[model samples]
Target: MDHVIKTLTPAARPPEAPGEVPAAPLRARPSRAEAEAAVRVLLGYIGDDPDREGLVDTPRRVVSAYDELFGGYHENPGEVLERTFSEIGTYDDIVLVRDIPFASHCEHHMMPFVGRAHVGYLPVERVVGLSKIARLIDIFAKRLQTQERLSSMIVTEIDTVLKPRGVAVMLEAEHTCMSMRGVQKAGSRTITTQFTGVFRDDPKEQFRFVSLVRNGIG
Candidate 1:
């Protein structure tokens, strides 16, 4: 018995402006009842009795969980770093926030990849709140993502918003899709990084960022 899984194909989009992070294309959304119906279908596909007393509300619960898990789709990354402060006098160096814990679903499998992000930037004239970096990470992590793309998105947003002299981003994660399924190699971790401006241009600065992230010192 061959079963087909339906997927949504987004229409072609125009080219994005330089330095702009491309957003997910808009598509017609299904109603809550329709979403729950699909969840029931998934439960049936897994050979479970979705209508059983123990599972009767599973569809509703799953739908509600998904709403919370994928809430990033409704957020705007541009707004995350909107507020900046420039009061620091002549303090122009790397500002790093390491060990920012995050959880994201892999775009391919929708399985979770739990990780920590290390972000740093060389402030030019202004700086954003340290907490905003963590919030920015959450905004991107709550969406379907690849570690590489997620790293790039974070760097780009910081560079665009802060116009920093450099930006650095590193992500270390254990992808459940790999450990829980293929090869079943549990406890394996993946690392990804992105650099721009001085971080990309100078090996010394890049090494400093890496060393700082690893050693927790300049």
Candidate 2:
């Protein structure tokens, strides 16, 4: 199947010198009550009584769940990576974190797709905490997204913020939209990987990263 690759620019920084594009305005979100009402409408549209004993509180519960599910919108990926440690000058090698679990709703069907993310980065001058890499994945996964776009976004965020020498990320997921509906192929899985800089230039390093991911080691 043909895949779409979107090339993203580096993270935007506040204008310090001059001639920078100002940040776009943020849109106001609907109130919780409105969101709950919308959910009820959707539940009713699907031929379920929103007022039924079992589902009476489902709308409110769904809205509350969304606060955590789609919370990536309210976060800043740049800020999550702002504090970096360059304490080691000569320690330049690959840093890989494997098997980070994540769950996300597909943009196309709004159904959940669960997965594990494996991330690796080659430090230029410094490195970030291992958990920060997992947090980065969480930031991107909690939004409605395609697995392809999600993989790209993770690499782009790390590339933009850490400014590493090279970065690599891989994600393998089982999309519920396929398993629970439509074609209903229960065991089908999608995998996406990205590499940058040296990881992209040198096949050996790319192979090494892939090997580490396969072996579940740093």
User: Evaluated with lDDT, which candidate comes out highest?
Assistant: 1
**Total backbone clashes of candidate 1, pairs 3 or more residues apart or in separate chains:** 0
Clashes of 2: 0
Task: Kindly list the per-residue Cα lDDT of model 2 for residues 73-102, writing each as its tens digit.
Answer: 656665667677878869899988899999
Residue runs of model 1 more than 4 Å from their true location after superposition: 1-25
List model 1 lDDT by residue over 1-218, tens digit each. 12232232323332232365786876667778999999999999999998899999998999899989987766667676888888989999999999999999999999999999999999988889999899989988988989988898889888887899999999999999999998999999999999999999999999999999999876
RMSD of 1: 8.4
What is the Cα-based TM-score of model 2?
A: 0.85
What residue runs in model 2 are displaced by over 4 Å at the alpha carbon? 1-27, 216-218
- Weakest ten-residue segment in model 2 by summed lDDT: 9-18
Instruction: In model 2, state the lDDT of residue 147.
Output: 95
Check candidate 2 and list the clashing pairs. Answer: none
Model 1 Cα displacement at 172 (Å)? 0.3
For every model shown, what is its TM-score relative to the native structure? Answer: 0.89, 0.85
